[model samples]
Each structure stands twice: as structure tokens, then as C-alpha cells.
Target: MRRRSFLASSSVLTIAALALPIYPARANEPFTEGQTAVLLRLVKDIFPHDALSDEPYLAVVEQLASAAADPDFLQLLREGMSSLDGAGEGDWIDRIEADRIAALKEMETTPFFITVRVSALFGLYGNPAIWSTFGYEGASYEQGGYLFRGFDDLDWLPEPLS
Candidate 1:
């Protein structure tokens, strides 16, 4: 096969794998499948990037699941999930997007919200695989900075002086 065809096929397979919904069932994970699903959906709501897939958001859930193995974190996470479920009418996950965002906003000062928000900042943006979605090319200092790269490639911004 030609190199171009091989690369294209590989890209397709990678996206297919990333696009699959995750139901984490690792040994010693503290969360139930239902809780994990809720966490996944919550992560997406927290970071609402339309162009990105669920893989990175699920990574945050998995990370929280692992942390929950510790007794203290486990309690915090359980309470957090419970709070989220109680934040809106019916089940929190089934609520409309606007309602969900309002519920989250109400909890902005809570420990759970702060923890998840901080974790998500790193978990979502730190994933190199999804960097292309935001037009980021990873660290550029090692490559002698963005001066010579596409630093000026953002067409949405006004043109720079020559």
C-alpha cells in the first residue's frame, strides 16, 4: 500500500476507536457503571467542545475513578456525584443542556465543582491527541518558538504588520 493510503487508514481507525463510548470496569475502580456514565456526561458538559470526541472527557472520568480508590477521595467523589444528581429536576443526566449548565453554575463554589473543573483543565487540554482540534501544535519552545511556525496563521485575526 502507498504511504498516503496507509496513513489515511490509520487515522480512520484511530478516530473510530476514540469515538467509541467508554464504560470503564477496571478492578478496584470505586464507581458503578451508572456513576461512570454520569461522570462522562458531566465532563463533556463541563468542557463543551463541539469538535472534540468523548475520549478525552472519558479520560477525566477514569482518572477520577482511579483517585476514588482512596477512601477520602472516594467519599468526596461519591458526595459530589450525589450532589450533581440532586441539582436538577428528575435525574440530573436526563435534564436539558440549559438546565444542566445552570445546575453546574449553582455548584461553582463547591469542592466537587472546583476539583472536577481543575482536573478537566489538565485532562482535556493536556491530551496531545486532541490538540489539533484547537489549532495547538504542542510546545514550540523546543522547536525555537512559534516565530517561524504558523504563529500568524490565524486567519480570523486581523493581518499583522509586515
Candidate 2:
């Protein structure tokens, strides 16, 4: 009888534990595809004509936006923009373009807009898939951990010093 009661109590506790929300998935809200495109265009304008072309920036922005369907990520983005004083800048695309350029200029001596644009250029140029597509082999193997290594094989010491 005592064992049965203990088992019942444990089961209830286990169920409750499982039911608790840790990090709930963000709500699905409509994201304007046009806005995303505009942001991409602005990112491109900021950072144009890298060796890998414009693929890296486009890919990252797309991936980030897709992943940003999560409320947490979107909220973080909103917070970051606010921290950068991006309120009421304009419509979604215009605001992003204007605020991003403004932030860049305000934060650094090297024309802020150009710096971000250059950053986008470098980011896209540095992506492995983009590099692979372009037939460029610089530092290919060095970034393999993030690009290809499977989770089951992660190790700390003696990093694949190849």
C-alpha cells in the first residue's frame, strides 16, 4: 500500500515536471515577404560585390528571418533595434534601411552605413556553401566544424588539428 502511494505521487510529480513550460515556442505571426525582401536589398546595398557575390548576405538574412519566426528571436531583434534607437524610423523596410545606416554612421568614425554594408559583403563572402559554389577553396577545411561535423562526434581536446 505504501509503495503504491509513493509510485502514484512520483508519477504525478513527473507528469507535472514534464508539463512545465521551459521556453515556449513563439507565436506564429504574419511576416511580410516584401519587408524581408526590402531588408535583403538594403543589406545588399550596404555590402555589395564581394568575391562570393551577394549569396552570403542573402542566405544569412533569409535563414535568420525564417528562424526568427520564433517570438524570442524576434523580440531580441526588436530590443536590439530599440537599443539602437530605431523607433518610428519608417515603414518596415524603409525603417530598417534608414535605421541601420544611421546606426552605422552614429556608432563609428568609418561611415556607419559603409561599415555595415562592408560587413554584409564580408559575411556573405565568408560562408562555406557560397564559397563552395564559387569554387573558392580558401580556409575551407578550417570552418568544417560548423559547416559539416555531426553532433555525435563533437570533442573538446585534440581538436581535429588537420
Candidate 3:
């Protein structure tokens, strides 16, 4: 096969694999589509900075999906989503202004919220696709590590006393 076709096929497989529930799927809950969507929304809400696009945010979605494959973690997510769904007079995601704020405040300390929040903090910000937006060159280890790369290349500091 041509290199282009191979790459295309590989990308398709990768996406399909990501969409699949993690191995050893829980017999209960089983990570439904609504639950996954809720997780994605939760991650985006927690990191509501405009600098990022939805692409990098998928890292958080993937992490939460994997975690949900664990029965206990799935329970946390289910309950959190339950609380989230019941938070407002209408749907939590659709509540306007103060209503949305109130809903978020109510669920801020929930296990699902905390789990998704902590996971997104560690998992989302570090995605390489997110780096270039802020002029980050990413890890130096791959380029013979940071030492040879002159990580402390800043020249703005005043000269040290001789």
C-alpha cells in the first residue's frame, strides 16, 4: 500500500480504538454516550480558557473514558453526572448566567467533578498540540534533553557581578 493510504488507515484505526471503551469494561454503567459527553463538557468547563481548541481537550476526554472503564471510577462519574443533571431547573449545560453558576457551585466538590478536574489539570495542559499556541517548544528530552538545548536561554537578566 502507498504511504498515504497506510497513514490514513492508521489514523482511522487509532480513532476507532479511542472510541472503544477501555478493555475490561464494567458490566454496569458501561460508559454510555451521554456520560462521555458529560465528561467532555465537564473538562471543558473546568479549563474554560479561550487559548485552547477542542482538539487538545480530547486528551481529558480520553483519560476520563479510560478511567470509567473501572467500575468504581464509573460509579463516581455516574453519580456526578446525576448530580449535574439535577442541578438546575432545566439542563445544567443550558442554564443561563447565574443559574449556570449556581449549578456549577452546587456540583463543584462532587467526585465526578473533582476526578475530571484533576485529570484535566494534569492531562489536558500538557498535550503537545496545545504547546505552540503559547510559544512553548515542548519537552527538550527528545532533542538530546534540555541541557544541550540551552533551556535557560533568557538574556533579559542583568549580568552577574564579576
Maximum-lDDT candidate? 1
lDDT for each residue of candidate 1 in 1-162, tens digit (9 for 90 to 100): 122232234343443343233335344368888888888888899899999888878888877776565576678678988998787788888899999899999997776776676556666776788998887788778999978876677899788788
lDDT string for model 2 (31-124, tens) is: 4565446546557655644554555666646544544555654554444433444534554345555566665456443232332333344346
State every prediction's TM-score relative to the real structure: 0.72, 0.38, 0.66
Candidate 3: where is the Cα deviation over 4 Å?
1-29, 142-158
Of the candidates numbered 1 and 3, which has the greater TM-score value? Answer: 1
Of candidate 3, the 10-residue stretch with the lowest lDDT total is: 1-10
- Best-first order by lDDT: 1, 3, 2
Model 1 TM-score on a 0 to 1 scale: 0.72
| Top candidate by TM-score | 1
Q: Model 2 — TM-score against the truth?
A: 0.38
Residue 4 lDDT in candidate 2: 26
Sort order, TM-score high to low: 1, 3, 2
State in Å the error of residue 68, model 1: 1.3
lDDT of 3 by residue, 1-162 (tens): 222232234343443443333333232245677666666677777777688877667666766666665566667677877888687686676666567666777776654555566567656655677878878888776788767666667789985777
What's the true lDDT of residue 9 in model 2?
Answer: 44
Superposed on all Cα atoms, the candidates' RMSDs to the truth, in angstroms, are: 13.5, 15.7, 11.9
